[model samples]
Target: MLPLCSCAVIQSHPTVSMLVTHGPVRCGEVRRAVTTTSSPGDKSRQRLRSVRAGAALTMLTPLCTLVYVATTWSAGNRPAMAMICVSMLVLAAVALAGAQAIERAGRRATVQMAGLVVNIAGFTALALLDGGLKSAVGAYLPFLVIMLAVGMPLRPFLAVAGLAVAGYWTVAIIGGPAQMSYAVIHTIHTGIIATLCLRYSAAMVSLQRRLSDLSRIDPLTGCLNRRGFEERLANELAEAERTGDSAVLLLVDLDGFKEINDRYGHQAGDDLLVWTGRTIDEQLRTHDAVGRVGGDEFAAVLSGIEPDGVPVVLERLHAALDGVASAGIGYACYPAEATSPEALKEIADRRVYRDKVDHNRQVPAEAAVAGARGDGARRQSAKVSRHERRRRAITETGRLGISTPGMGLLYVLLFAGGHPNRWLMATLLTVAVTLGVTTVAAAARLSRSSAAAMIMPIVGALQFTICTVVVCLDGGASSTPALGMLTTLPLIALISPRAVLLPFAASAFVAIAVFVGVSSTWYAIGHLTSALVVSLVCASRGRVAAEQRRKLRELSRVDALTQCLNRRGFMERSTAELAHAHRHRRDLSLLILDLDRFKEVNDSEGHAAGDELLCWVGATLRERLHPHDVVGRLGGDEFVVLLSSHSAGETDDVAGDLEAALAERIGVSVGAGVLGRHGTDLEGLYAHADAELYRRKLARGRGRSRRPAAPADGNALVA
Candidate 1:
C-alpha cells in the first residue's frame, strides 16, 4: 500500500481550528515521526529510472543467451529449441513488466515476488528445452546461476532456490541412473551454497540498513540527527525548486533545556527531550520532517504549506509543546525567503535565536532565579550534566554509539573464519545488534540516555578482548595484535586522546603480557607507541574542527550590542520557564516595558547617545532584577521580562521598581500579566502586557494634552 496523508483547511475571519490538517503521525512519537520526504520531484523517481535501466540490462543477458543456444544447439529437435526461445523471451518481457509496475508503486516486496515467479518459470522452461532432461541439465545450470544474480530480496531468493531444487528433481526423474545420481549430488551442493549466499546477503542488507539509520538518526531521541535533517532540507529545497512549490523550515530549540539537564538530572532532561521530539512529530504531517539538530534543538520541514498556512501550522506546533516544554521556533520559506538550503537554515536559525531572546527577556522573576540555580528543586535525578554524559560516552565507548552492529560486524570479519573465535565473533555480532535496538527502548524506559552511549562501547571492547584471547589461545598465530590495534584505536581518537591512553595502554599491556609473554613485549610497545602517534594527530584535527563549530554556534545567538541574551536567546529561556511554571502550578508573570519619548531623544541627541542611553537602560534593568531574571530588548526601546514564581502583586512591585528607576531619565511604562489570569501563552502574555502599556501611554497623552499649552520658544513654559 502507498502510505500517504492529506490535510484540509477551512479558515474564517475569527478563530482558526486546531484540526486544520490531519497528519499520519499521532501525538507522542516525536523521535519516531515519519516523513515521506519523497515528492514528485524527489530521488524516488530517479531510482525508478535506475531500476528500469537494470531491468534492461537483466533482459539483454537472457535474450542473448537464449538466441545463442537456439542457433548453436537446436540440431535435431528444432521445434523444442524454438519453444524454449519463445518462452525465455516471453518470460523476460513479463519480468520487465512486473518490475515496471513495482517501480510505479515503489514497493520492494513486489520486486521480490515478481522476480521469484519469473526465475522459476525461466528455469522450468530451460529444463524442458532439449531432447531430454539429461542434455538440458548442463545447459540449464548456467541459467540457475543467472537467476541467483537477479536482485531479489531474501524471501523470493529462497523461493527461487526451492524451485531450482524442484527442477533438479524433475530432471533426475527424466534422466538415466548415472545421470540421476550426478544431478542429486549437484543439487545438494547447489542448495548448501545458495543457503550461505542467502545468509550473507541478509547480513549485508542488515548491516547496510543499520548504517543508513545511524547517519540519519539522533541516537538518543531517535529523531533525525543533524546530518539527516540537513540532507532532508536539501531534498525539500530541490523539490520546491523543481516543482515551483513552497515549504517552511522550522528550527525549534527548547528553552531552559540546559537548566533541566542541570537541575532535574540528565535523565529527566533526556525524557523531556524525548517528549519534545514526540510532541513536534505529533504536530507535523506525514510529509513533514522533525529533526533534533542541536542538543536541545529540533528543525522541521513542512511541505504543502501556503503563505497563509504558516501561522496555523506554527500554532499547532506550539500547542503540542505547551506544558511539557517551551519551544522557540524560527522558520523560513523556500522560493519566498531563501533560494537554497543553507540560506534557509541560516535564516531560520537566526530567527529561532531571536525568538529565544524574546522568550528569555519576558521570563518571570522567580523562574529566572530557578533557572540560574540550575537545579530542579522538585525532581532532581542523579547529578549529571549533558557534557558529563557525553564525556562518559566517549571515555566509556569512544563512540557516538550510532552503529554498533555495523562496527561489530567489521570486528567479526577481522577475526576471520579459521579463528576459534569466529563463533565467538558471531555471538558478539548478534549481541551487538540486539544491544543497539534494545538500548533505545531501555533508555526511554529508564529516562536516561547515558545508557544509550555507554552500552555499545562496552560491548565493542568486550568483543575485541574476546577476539584477542581466542587468537592468543591459538598461539598468536593470527594477526591478533594487528586487529586489536585497529579496533582499539577508536578509543583513542573519540575521547581525549591523551587522557584515555593510559588506561587503554595499561589494559593492552596486561592482555599482551598474558598472551604473548615477555618475548613479544616489543610488539605490544610498538602497538601502543604507533597508536599514540596516530591518536595525537587525530585529536589535534578533531578538536580544532569541534572548537570552530562551537564558536560559530555561540556567535550566532549572542547579541552584538547589549551583550545580554538577544531576542532569540530570551525566548529560548522564557518558553521553557513558562512551560515549567505552568506544569508545576507555579506563579508566573510577564512585564513589558518601553521608554517614553525615546524617539524624541534620538532626534534631539545623536544616534550614538541614543545607543548609549539604551545600553544604560539595559544595564540598569539587569542590576535592579535578580540574576535569575532574563531581560531582552525587542528592537527599538521596547523591553520585556518573564517573571517566574511572581504573583500579581509581586509582578506589580517589580514593574513599579523598574519604572521608578527610569523615571529620572526619559521614563519607562510597565505593564504586567500573571499566568492563568493574564494568559498562559508566551505571545498572549506579551500582548496583554503591551495592551496595558498602551493604556498607560494613552492616559499620559490625555493628561499632557490638557496641561501642556507651551509657548513657542519653550523657555517661558519651564519657568
Candidate 2:
C-alpha cells in the first residue's frame, strides 16, 4: 500500500518539482548524492574517500557471498568452505586496495591497466584455488567488466574481454563438465557489456563532430564568423610564429552600400552583398581564409606569404574587388606590417575605410559623366528651366520696388565727375548703375506700376550722370557743377534749413587753398570754389539715396517671417544660374514642394500652430539642404528649390532625400518635379513638378506611394 501510494504521488508531479516541494529532506538527499559522486580536493584526498567507500562496499559484497557459502556448506559439503571464506576475505581486501590505488594514481592509462591486472590476477587465483569451474567464477565476471569499462580505455576493455574468455575456457577445462553452465553464463554477460561499450563510444564521437561544426561555421556568409575567425587566427598566428612564416590579412568593405540601399530596395542591396562575398571567395587563394566581420565588412587571412608580398596580394584583391560593383579592398601583413594578429586586423580595417573614402569621392564625377552620356535633351531643358527661374526672380524684385545699397555707390560716382579723384567717382557710378538696372528690371517684371516709379528716378540719375561726365570731359562750362548742386542741395536743405550756406562755405575754403598753392585771381578762385561746392553737395546726396535703396532691396529679397531669401531673391539668382547652364550646356533641376494638408493645421490646431509649422519646416529645410541649393517659400504652403550641376537623375535623388527628410517630421507629402534638356522651361518645370506633387498627394491618400518615381527620362517627379 505504501509503495502504491508513493507511485501515485510521484505520478502526479515531475520528480524534480516534487523534490523541490519536499524542501530540506529532498535537498539533503540530493546533496548527499552529489558529495558521493565527486569531491573537491587534491587527487589523494578524493582517492582516499573513494577508497573508503569502495572498501566498505566490497567488504559487504564478500560477506554476503560468505553467507551464501555458509548456507551451501551447511548442506554438508564443507570440504573447501573454510578456504573459500579466507579467500573471499583476502580477495575483497585486495580489490579494495586496488581500487584505492587506481583512484589515487588518477587513472592514467598505465595505472588503470595495472589495476585491471590486479583484479584479473585476484579473480584468476580465486578460480584456480576454488577448483576453477566448480566455483561461481562467472559471478565475478560482471564486476571485472564494470571496473574495466568505467575506469579504462578501449585497450583495457579488450584486455578484460580477452581475459574473461580465457578465464572461462580455463574454468571449463579445469572443472571439466561440472562448470559448463557457469562458463556459458559468463560468456553471455561479457558479450552484452562489450556491445554496450562500443555503442556508447560511437555516440560520443558523433556528438563531438556535431559540436565542432556548429562552433566553427557562420550561417549567413557560410564563412567563419567573428568567433571562429578569432579562434582560427590565434591558431594561425601560433603556427606562423613556430614555423617562422608570415601571413597576410585583408579587410574588405563594400562602398556605397547605404546609398544603394536607399536608392534601390534593401533586397537588391542584399543581393549585392551576396554577390560580393562570392566574388571575394573566388578571388582569394585556397590557403586564404575569409570571414564576414560586420555589415558590409569582410576580412581575410592568407598564409605562406612574405611581408613584402602582402602589397601584391592586396593589389590582386583590389583588382578583384574592382570588378565587383561598389567594392573596396584593404590589407595588412604579419611579421612586417604588424607584429600581432590583432594589430594586423586593425591596420587592414583602417586601410579599408580609407579605400571606401577614396571610392566615395569618385562617385560624383562618375554620375556626372553618366549623365552627360545619357541625357543631352534633359540637360538643355534644365538650362531653360533655370533661365525662367531667374526671370521670375527679377519680376518679384521689381514689384517690391527695392534697390540694394550696392546700387547707391553708382549714383555717387556719376555725380562726382572728373575731380582729381575721378577713378573713385567712376567706380561708384558703375556700382550704382549696375544695381539700379538689375533692380529696376526685376521690379518691372514683378509689378509694372511699382517698377515704373522705381525706373524713373534710376533713369533720371543715369541721364544726369552721363550729361555731367560729358560736360566735364569736354572742358565746357561744366554741367557737372550744376548737376552736383541740384543733387546735393535737396539733401542739405532737408537735414538743416541753413544747409544752403554749407556749399558756400565749402567753396570759400577750397578757393582760399587753391590761391595759396597757385596764386590764382578772384575769377579763377570763383570757378574752383563752385566746382568744390558742387562736388561736396553731390557726394552727400548720393550717400542718402544709396542708403534708401539698400533698405528697399533687403525688404524685397528677404522673407519677413523666416528671414531667409524670399521667392524674388531666389528667382533672380536662379535666372543667372539658367544663363550659366545654357552657356555651359550643363544640367539644372527644380524642386517644387507643396505641404500636403497644411490647411488642416490652421483649421484644427489654429493659425498659431500653422505658423509654427511653417517656421519649423523652413528651419528644417534650411538645416537639411546643401549650402549651394537654392531654397525659397513660394507664398502660402508652397516652396521651390533649384539644384545646380545635377543631372535629371541626380536632381531626383536630391528631391527624394528632401522628401525623406521632411517625412521624418510633420505628416506632409512632398513632391518634386524635374525639367532638363528643353523638356520644359523653368515655369513649365515648376508646373510639371506641382502636378506631379499633386499626383503624389493623391497616391499617398490611396496608400500607393512607395518610393517616389524617378523621372521618365531619368528625370524624377516625387510627391
Candidate 3:
C-alpha cells in the first residue's frame, strides 16, 4: 500500500501547530503559504519520479507473479492466477502511461488510490482462487502493506494494513483448523511488519518536514532566509504577472549596523537583526513576504500593490523604523519600475544606497537642532570591554587546547603501552595531564583575550617540546613521533597572529637544522620540508583572510562618493582625538560646515553636478587642512572637520580661511566649537558646532547680516 501522494501534510504535524499565531508572519506562515500555493519544481520532479518508480514496481511485481504461476502451478490453477497477474499488469501499465497527465490534472492521489484498490482485489482473488490462506499468493499481502506504509497518509495506511491482515486471516480461517495455527503465525508476522513500516514512514515524513523548515528559515530571526525569499518572490511575481496585478519589491539596509556591532557586541547585533526582521514583517501585509537577504539587510515583496500606493507604504515603513536606528529604504514596482525580480532588486538596491546617503546628511543636521532644543541625542552603548573579549577567547581556546592533550594522554597510555621508553612515555603522560589541568585553571582565571592568545601558543610550544624530546629519545626525527610535531603548527597558526608566524617558523627551522645535524635521514628531510610547506600555506591563508577583513572594515568606514570618512568613521576618529586632547591637554576644535543653498545646485544643475561639487569640496578641504586633521562628509550637504592641536584662535582663523576659500567658488557657511568652551566629548562638540551652523544658515536665509561678530570667547565664530 504505497502512499497515494508524497506531498507534505502540514496540518498533520502537531509541531507546526505549536507555532505562535499572533506575531508578524514568520517562517511558519511563509512555508505554509508556499507549500500550499506553489508547485515547487523540486517537489514536482520528485513526484514524477515517485510515480514512475511506483509504476515500475507495480508492473514488475505482477509480471514476476505471472511467471511464477506459469512455472509452479497446475494448468487449472495457472489460468486463474495468470488472469489475476495480467489484470494487475494492465493496471500498472495504464498508471505508468498516465503518470504525467495525472500529475498535471492534480488527480494523482485519486488514481493512486484506485490502483491500490485494484491491486488488493487482484491479490485477494489470487490467494482465494489458488489455495486460500496457505497459498504463496498470501505472502504478497504483506508486501502490499510495506508499499502502502511508505508514503501513504497514516489513517489510510492503517486502513490498508488492517484490511490486508483481515483478508489473510479470513482466508486462513476458511482453510480449517489445520491451517489455523499457520494462519495465526502468519497474521502476527504481517501485523508486526506493518506496524514497524508505519512507524518508520511517519518518522521519515516528520524528518522531511523538519528539514524543509530548517532550509527556508533564518534561525535567529524566524524569517525566511535568502533561498526561501527568492523562491517565494519568484512565485509571487509569476502570479502577479498572470493576474495582471502589481507588486512592490523593497530593499532595506540598517544604517550604522557595523558601528552597533562594534560598540555593543555580536549578541546585541544579532538581537537588532532579529528586531529588524520583525519590524519589517509588522509593516507588511500578511500575504507579503519579508526575508533577511544580507547582514543588516532585509527584503520584502508586497503583492497587489499599485505604483501610486508605494509612496504611502514607504512613508509608513520609514515612520515605524525612524523610532529605532535610521534605515535606508528603496522600492521598485513590478511592471512599472522593473518587470523582473532581479531588475526590481537592482533598482531597489540603488535607491537604498541613495537613501542612505541622503539619510546620513540629514540626520546630523536634524540631531544638532534637536539637541539645541534640550532633546538629548541617543547615547551609544559602551564598547565591549577588552577584558570580556579576552576571557571569551581564552575559554574558547581552552576547549580545544585541553581536549587535545587529554586525548593524546589517553592515546599514549592505550596504544604505546609496549614502547621501550617507559619512563619517557610516563613523563609525556604526566606533562600532558599537567598541561590540561593548568590550561583549564588558567582559562578560568583569565579575563583577557590576549592572555588566552599567549597561553595557547605557549601550550602548543610545550606540547611540541615534549613530543620532540620523545622523538629524540625513541628514534630521532624519522620516528613516528615526528608527525606529532606537525599538529603544533596548526595550533600555532590558530592562536598566533601574523607577526608570530615568521619568528616561530624561523625558530622551528633552526631547531630542525640541529636535529638534522644529529641524524640526517630522508624521512627527516621530508618531514622538515612538509612542516615548512604547511607553515607557508597557513601563513598565506592567514594573510589573505586578514587583508579581506581590513578591506571590509575600511569599506564600512569610508564614504563611497567623497572617499572621506563616513559618519561612523568620523565619530570613531573624532572620539580618539577628543580622548587625546583630554589626556595631553592639547587644543582641539570642531567645525560644522553646510553648503549654503545646496539644494539650488541640484535643482539648477542636476544631481551629478551637485555630486561633482561635493567631491570637489572634499578634495579642497583635504588640501587646505593639515595632514593630521580629519575631514568627513556626514551625509547630504553637511561636512565636519576636526582641527587637531588647534587653539580656539587658530581654529577660528582656519574656519574663516576655509569659508573664504569655499565661498570663492560656492556659497558656504562655517561654525566652530572650541575645546573647553563648547563641551568635552565628541557629541557635545558636534551639537554646539551644528547649532552655530544652523543659526548662520537661518541668518543667511532671512536677508540679515551675513557675518556676525565673534562671540565673547572669540572661539565661537560664524563665517
Candidate 4:
C-alpha cells in the first residue's frame, strides 16, 4: 500500500499552515507579503517565470516516465507494473491539463498543488512496484522537491517536503522491512536540496529588491523620478475618477534658468535645482506628489482637492517661488479642464508657455536647449574600463570552472559505491584533481593581471576539451560526465568574449559530435540541440546582467540632481587622474567654486527653485568644460573641478571665463592651485586653493562665506 491509503487528501488553503496555497496567482501580491526591497511587479514576474518553468517540466516528467515504462516491461511483476504504468499515464494526463491551466492565466496555484499531489502519488507507486527505498526511482523524489522549492513559497514547500519524506517511509515499510541506511541517506539528500533551495530563494529576493530601487526611485531629489511620478499620477487619477473627486496638475518651468546656468557654472545651477525640488516638496501635502519631469521643468499632482480650495494652494505655491527664478506656473483641474493625464499635461504646458510669454517679452527669443548631452559625455571614459569588464566576465566563468574537479570527484566516489571501475575511477579522479588545481592557478593569474583576460578563451577551450575526454572515457553522452558538457558548454558561451565565442561554440559542437561513437547517436544529437538552446539563453542573460551592472555603477557615481560626480565619485576619479598626471609629469590644477549668497536664495524662492538653479549650474560647467575635466559637488554650494594638464596661466584664464559666465545672476568666487607650484599632493593643493578662495572672499568683503571650506586634511583625496 502507498501513502495514498491515508484517505486524508491534503486540502489546499490560502494560509501558511496549509499544505498548499490555492488562489488566483496575484503577480506582485506574494512579493509584497514579504518585506522585499524589490517592487511587486519585478518579483511577480520572476515568480511567474519560475512557475511556468516548473509547471512545464512537471508536466513532461510523468509523460517521460510512462514512455520509459511502456518500452521496458518485465514479465515477473506484470500485474503490479502494469497498474503503476496505468497510473503514470493518468498522472501525465492530469499534469498536461494543469500545465495548460497555468499557462492560460499565468500561474494557477490550485493546479500547481494538484500537480504536486499527482507527482508524489505516482513516484510513490513506482517505488513500491520497483524496490521501495532501494529503487533508483525513489532518488528522483529530491528532484521534485527541488522544483517545488524554486516555484513555491518556503512554507508550502516545506509541507511538500514533509509529505515526500512520509511517502518514502510509508512505501519502504509496505514493501517490507525498511532499510535504515537507505532511509537516512535519502532523507539527508532531500534535506540538503531543501537547504540549497532556501538559500537561493533568499538571495534572489534580496537582489530583486535592489534592482527595484534602482529602477524606480529618483537619485537626485529624493523624490519620485519621472517614471515613478507617472505611475503615481495614473493611480491618483484613477482614484479621482472612481471617487468623483477632483485632481489638480501643475507644471512649473524655471524662467531665465539658462541665463543663470550660463553665468554661474553648473554647480550653482545644480544647487538652485536641488533647492527648488526640496522647497516645492515641502510646500505640498504629504500625499501630494512632485517630480522633475524635464531639464528645467517640474510637475506636481494634488489629489482630492476641491476647485474652490485650489486658489489657496496656488497662493502658497506662488509665494514659495517668488524671486526664485521667475517660474512660469500653469495648472489644469482634472474632470474640469481635461479628463486624461495626457490632456491635463498638455493644457498645463500650454498655459505655462503662455504665462512665460506674458511675464517676459524675451520669451519669444529664448529657445529650449537641444539634445542636452548627459553626464556620461562629461567623463573621459567609463568608471570600469573595458579591460576590467572583460576580466570580470571571465572571472565568473573561472569561479564556476574551479568547482568542476570537486563535482568530478563526487561523481567518482558515487560510481565506486556500485560499479567495477576502480582503475577508471582513479584515473578520472587524478585527471579531475590535476585540472582543478590548474584552473585555480589560472584564475588567480587572471585576477592579478589585466592582460590575462585574453587568455581566458584558451582556458575555456581546455575546459571543454577535458569534458570531451571525460565523456569518451566514461562511456559517451549517456554517461554522468556527459551531462557536465551540457552545463559547462552553455556557461562558456555566456562568459566568453564575443571574439572567442564563435570558435569556442564551433569546437564545443565538434566535441558533441564525438559523443555519437561512445554513446547513442540520438542522445548525442539531443545533447547538441539542448546545449545550443541553453547556451543561447544563458548568453543573453549574461549580457543583460552585464549591462545592468554597468548602469547601476554609473548611477552610484553620478550626483542625482546635477549629474556631476558626487563627492565620492570625484575623489575616486580625481585620485586616478591625479596619479596619471603625476606619472606623465603633466600640469594639473584644482579649482573650488563657492556660490555667493546661495543660502539666501534657498530661503526666499524655496529649495525646489534653488535645486533648479543648481542643476543649471552643473549643466553650465559640464557644457563649458572639456570632457577630460572633472566636475564634482563636494557637499553644499561648493563645486570642485580638476583640470588635468592645465598650466597656471591657462587655469587662471578658465577661471576668468567662469566668473564672467556666472556674474549676471549670481556671483562666484574662484580659488586656484597648481600641482608642484602650490603643493605636491591633492590635500596640499586643496589647502592652497582654499587659502586663495578665502583671500578673494575677504577682498570682496564677504567675510568668509557662511559655509566653511572643506579642510585640506591628509584624506582629502580619499573616497
Candidate 5:
C-alpha cells in the first residue's frame, strides 16, 4: 500500500518527474511547479536555511559520538571510532558548502545525497562497534538513519533507509551471537517507521498543492481567479503570437441578474453562477480560459480561434445559458485587430463598452426588464434573510451582545430585601437575562434597519429602570443595588450606543434624584464615577465596533468605485419596495440606464476618466432622485433605479429628466418599466426595462445608418 501510494503521487506531479527518468537521487524542478504554501523563490530561500541548520547538526553529531565513546569505549571500537572521526570531518565540511550550493537545484540534490552518505556511515559505525540491537549505542543508530528523511525527497529518503537496514542486519547477525530471528523482527520494525517518514514527505507536497489551488482558483466557481486568469491570458497571447493564429477575448456581463437575486433569493443566484461557470467551460476547448473577473461579470480568452469562430462559440454559450442569462459578448481578434495583447485587450474592452452603449441606444425608454441572478451576486442583504443577518452580526462581534444585561444580574442579588422588592428584582433580572439571550437569538432578524437596533436596547434599559425603582423603594441612592443600576446603564450602552443608552441613563439618574432627595448628593459621587468609567469604556467599544461594522457593510453592499449599492443591495431594497407596492396595489416603476459611448471615452481618454464618469453618474442620480429612490450599479456600465410610489407615467417622466440632465454631461439612454404594465415584481420590471433599453439602442443605430439625400436640390440646381 505504501509503495503504491508513493508511486501514485510521484506519477501525478510533474515536478517530481525526475525521480522516474533520472537516478532516484537527482533533484527535480519542484518549486512553483508544485502547489505549496510558499512560492518557488520562497521555497529556495527555505532550502538555504534548512541547509545551514543541517550543517550545524552534522557537526554536533560527531561531538555526541565522541561523548558516548569516552563513556563506554571497549577495545573492539578503535577501528569504528577512526571511521566515525573521518566521516564526521568530511560531513561537516560538505554541509558548510552545501548551504550555498543548495540554492542551485542540481547542487541541492547532490548535497542532500552527501548528507545521506554521512547518515549511513554514522549508523553503520554504531551497528558494527556496539553490541548489536541490544546495546544503547546500537539503539541510537535507527533514529539517526530516519532523521535524514526530513528534507530529502521520497526516493532519496527511502534509499538512505535501505542502507540503514542492510547495516543493521549485518551488525545484528555478526555481533548478536548469530540471532537471525531478532534481526528480522527489529529490521521489520525499523522499516515500518521509515515508511511513515517517506509518507510524511509526500503528504507535505500534497498540502502545498492545496494551498496553491486556494490562491489561484475561485472558491465559488472553480475558475481561475483574476490573477490566475491574467496569467493564463498572457500565456495564450504569447502562444498565438508565436503560432500565427488569433485569440478572442469576451467580457460577459450577465443581464438583469440582480432581479433574480431579489425575487428567488441568494442561493438561487449562487446556483446560477456555478451553472454559468460550467456552461462557459463546456463551450470552450480545454486550452481556453474563463474567469469570474468581478460580480456578475465573466471574462474569457479563446486562443488560436479566428474572428468567425468567435460567434459560433458565443452562440453555443447562449444556447447553454438559455434564457437564464443573456451574455453580452465583446471580442477582438489577434493579428486582425491588433498584434499586441494589451492593445487587443483594450480593443475588446472598448467593444464591450460599445455593445452596452449600442444596446442602450436601441432599446425603448419605457420598458422594465427582469434580470436573473448568478450565484456570485445572488444573496440578499441581512434585512431580507435571517441567516445572513445572524452571520454578519456574529462575524463582526463574535457574540450576541451578551453583556447587555450583565450588570442587571448583580442588581438582582444586591436588592434582595422585602418580599415585594425581592419579587420585583427577580422579575427584572429574569426578563433582563431572557431578553439578553433573545437579543442574540434575534440577530438573524436584526440589521441596519432602525427598528432592529432598538429592540434589545429598549428592553434592556426598561429592565434596568424597573430594578432601579425597586432599589430606591428599599433604601434609595444610598443602597448598593440602586448604585448598581448606574453600572447597568453602561452595559446597555455597550450593546447599543448614544441613541438608546444616554436617554435611558439620564431618565434613571433623574428618578434617583426625585426619590433619594438632596441628602443623597454626596452618594451620587460613586454612582457618577461608576457611570463615567463604564460609560466611557462601553462607548469607546461601541464606536470602534460601529466603525468596523460600517466598513464591513460597505465592503459587502457598496460598489468600490462608484460608491453606490451593488447588485445585491439594490436588488434587496428594490424587492422589498416592489412587494410593498404589490400588497397596496399601488403603481411602481423601475428605470434602467446605460451611458452612451462610455467605451469610446474610456478608450480615448483612459480608465480614470471612465471611473470619474461612473462616479459622477452615481452622484448625479442620487442628487436628482427622491429620497426613497433606490439606485444601484449592476456591474460594468449598467445602472438601475427603483422608484417607490411612482406610477408608470411618473417613472417615465423622471427617467426622461435624468436623460436630459445627463445629456449635457454624458451620453445617456434610459428605459422605464411600470409595475402594473410590466411584470409586478423586481424580476418582471427589470426584464421589461432592459428590453426597452435594448430596443431604443437598436432604433438609434438604424436611424444613424440611414443618411438623408442632402445634395439633390443644391447639386441639381447648380448643374
Candidate 6:
C-alpha cells in the first residue's frame, strides 16, 4: 500500500516545474504586451544623438590606435612593441565593428552604449597587455572627450572615464609602480576631466531632446506634426506585423476650418484649431497618440485594440467634437477600415468634407434669407427708378418726333419701278414662288421628315416653273437675268440669314431668267456678267457669316481647361440623343467619372497642379477611348461619357480599365457609373448615370474599392 501510494504521487506530480522552479509565461502573451508597449513608445520615443557620436568615436578609435602604435614604436622596446602592434590591430577591428553597429542601428541606444563599453574595454585590455599606455593614454583622451561631446548619457560617460582610468593604472602597475605624488596628481586630473565630460554629455542630451521636440511637435497645437505622425505610425505597423497584434490608426480632420477662417478671421480659426487639438488629445488614451498631420487635420494611433473597436472610437471622437461651437469632425480607422495611410486619410477627408457640406448647407439658409430680403428691397427701388427713366425717355422721344432710320429706304425700293416691265414683274413673282418652295424644301430636309422629303421635289419643281415663267416672259434674254435674280435673292435673304435666304435665291433666279429671255444678245451677256458679279459677292458674305457662327458654337461647347465639351453641350447632346433613342427604341448608356481628393491637390500644390492633373486626365481619357465614344468634361474635375452600343457589363469593364489607367498616371481614384437601356432618353440616362457616379464616389469616401468606367469605343460620341 505504501509503495502504491508513493508511485501514484510521483505519477500525479509532474516534475517539469520542479526542474525549473519558475515556469515561463506564454510567448504569445509576452509578445502581445511588448507590441502594445512598443507602439506607444514608437510615437513618443525620444531620438538620441549620442548614437551618431558613438559611431564617430568608433571610427576615430582605430586611427588613434595607429597613432599610438607609431609613437610607441619611436619609444621602442622590442618585446613590448610586438604586443603593442597585436593589441592595436585587435582594438582597431573591434572599433570598426562597433562603429558599423552603431551606424546601422540608429534607435538602439542600448546597443550603442554596449558598443562604447566594448570599445573602452578593448582599449583597457590593450593597455594591460602592452606597455604603450604612457604614450597611448594622451592619444586616447581626445576620443573619450569626443564620445562625451556627442551625447552619451552620464552613466556611459562615467563608465568610459572609469575604464580609461583603470586601463592607465593597469599599465602603470604592470610597467612598474608609480610614485605616490604622480598617482595623486593623475587622480585629480582624471576626476576633473571626467566631471567636465559628464557635464557636457548631460548638456548634449538636453539639447537633443529639445531639438527633437521642436522637429516633431506642431507649434500651434502641441500635437505631433505630419512627419512625426508618419514615422510613428510606420513603426507601430511594423511592430504589429511582427507581434501579430491588432492596432488601429484614425485620421481626424476638422470640417469648415476655412469657413471659420474666412468669416471670423484666422486668429479665431487658429484658436479653434488649438481647441480641437486639445480636445482630441484629452479624448485619447495615454497609450494612444495624436498628431496634427495637416492644416485642420489630425491623426491618432490606437494600440492593442480590436479592429472592430474602430467604430466605437470614432463615435467617442464624434461625441466629443459635436456641438463644439463651430467644428465638424471626421475620422477613419486602420486595419478595420483601410490598410494604407493614404487610404485612411482619404476616407477621413471625404467624411470631413461631407460634414462640412452639411454644415454649409444649413449656413446658406440664413444667408439666403438675408440675400432675399436685400434683393426684394433692391428690386422695388430699381423698378420705380426704371419706370421713371422709361417715361422720361419716351417724353424726350415724343418731343423730338424721332423715328428709326431705314423705313424710307424700304419704301423707295418697294415703289421704285412703278409699272415695272412685264418681264421684270414676272421675274419678281417667279422669284417669290421659287424661294417659298426652296425654303420649305430646305426646312423639310433639315427636319429629316419623310413628308418633307416627299414635298422637296414638288418645291424644287415649283422653283423651276417660276424660272420657266420668267424666262418665257423675257424670251431668250431671260436666262442671264434669271440667274442674276436667283443669286441676289439668296444674298438678300442672308440679312435675316436662315429665314430669308431661300426666298432671296428664288427672286434672284426669276430675275435672271426674265433678263436672259427678254434682252438682246448683248444685253443678255451684260445681264449675265452683272448677275455673276452680284452672286459672287453675296456667296462670299454668307460664307463669312456662317463661319463666324460656327466658331461661336464651338466656343460655347468647349471647356477652357480641358478643351472637352462643356456642361451645356453635354445637356444639349444628351437631350437630343435621348429623344432619338426614345423614338427608335435604340440602346444608350451614359457614364459619369469624378476624380477623388482633387481639392487636396488644389490646396497643397496650388491650383496649377490641379489644372495640370485635370488636363492629363482628359488626355488620358481621349487616348484610351474609342473614336465613337463621346467624352465630355463637366465642371470641376468631373467628366461624362456616352456609349452608344455598350451593355452594362461592358460599360463596367470599361470603367474599371479607365480607373486602373488613371490610377497609374495620377494616383487619383476614378469613380464611374453607368446608365443602361432603362434610361428612356438622354436626360433619364444622364440622371441614372449621375446617380451611379455619386454612389460610387460615396463608396470611395467610405474607403471601398471601386472600378472605373469602361474604355470608350473609337466610334462612341464624344462631346
Using lDDT, give the best candidate's number: 3
Q: Roughly what TM-score does model 2 have, to 2 decimal places?
A: 0.35
lDDT of 5 by residue, 617-669 (tens): 99999889988888888655678888884666777789888998788778776
lDDT winner, 3 or 4:
3
Ranking by lDDT: 3, 4, 5, 1, 2, 6
Model-by-model lDDT, in order? 0.51, 0.47, 0.59, 0.57, 0.54, 0.46
Which is superior by TM-score, 1 or 6? 1
The TM-score values for the models, in the order shown, are 0.40, 0.35, 0.47, 0.55, 0.42, 0.38
Ranking by TM-score: 4, 3, 5, 1, 6, 2
| Best-fitting candidate, scored by TM-score | 4
lDDT preference between candidates 1 and 5, better one: 5
lDDT per residue for candidate 3 within 43-157, as digits (tens), equals 5765676666667666755775676676666535788788878888887788788888877788777766666677667777777776664354544565455444433578877
lDDT of 1 by residue, 1-719 (tens): 00000000000011011101112122323222223444565545655554554444445424543554555563555566556546645654664566557666876345544544554455455455543333422324423432242233555456655765676666567645545544543454344333433443343333323333433454445566555676677767777787888999888867655445324433455556656776677677766877765546678888768767888877787776655577778889877898887788778777766666675422123343334334222211112122432433332332212233344345446435476666765665465445545544444333344474455446546545544454454354223333233323433353443334446545765565566653344334433443343344334433543443344333323343454554445666787788788788888888877677664454355334666787788888888887877787643466777777456668888888888987767688777777789676776676566557656765776112111221122111011
Q: Weakest 10 consecutive residues, lDDT, candidate 1?
A: 1-10
Report clash pairs, candidate 3. Answer: 1-144, 1-147, 1-148, 2-147, 2-148, 3-152, 361-635, 361-636, 390-448, 390-449
Give the local distance difference test score of model 4: 0.57
lDDT of 1 at 144: 43
**Superior candidate under lDDT, 1 versus 6:** 1
Off by over 4 Å in 5: 1-462, 473-486, 499-524, 551-555, 579-586, 594-628, 645-647, 653-669, 699-719
Worst 10 residues of 3 by lDDT: 2-11
Candidates 3 and 6 compared by lDDT, better number:
3
Which stretches of candidate 2 lie above 4 Å from their native place?
1-123, 130-160, 258-288, 335-341, 358-719
Question: After TM-score superposition, what is the CA distance of residue 491 in candidate 5 from its true location, in Å?
Answer: 2.1
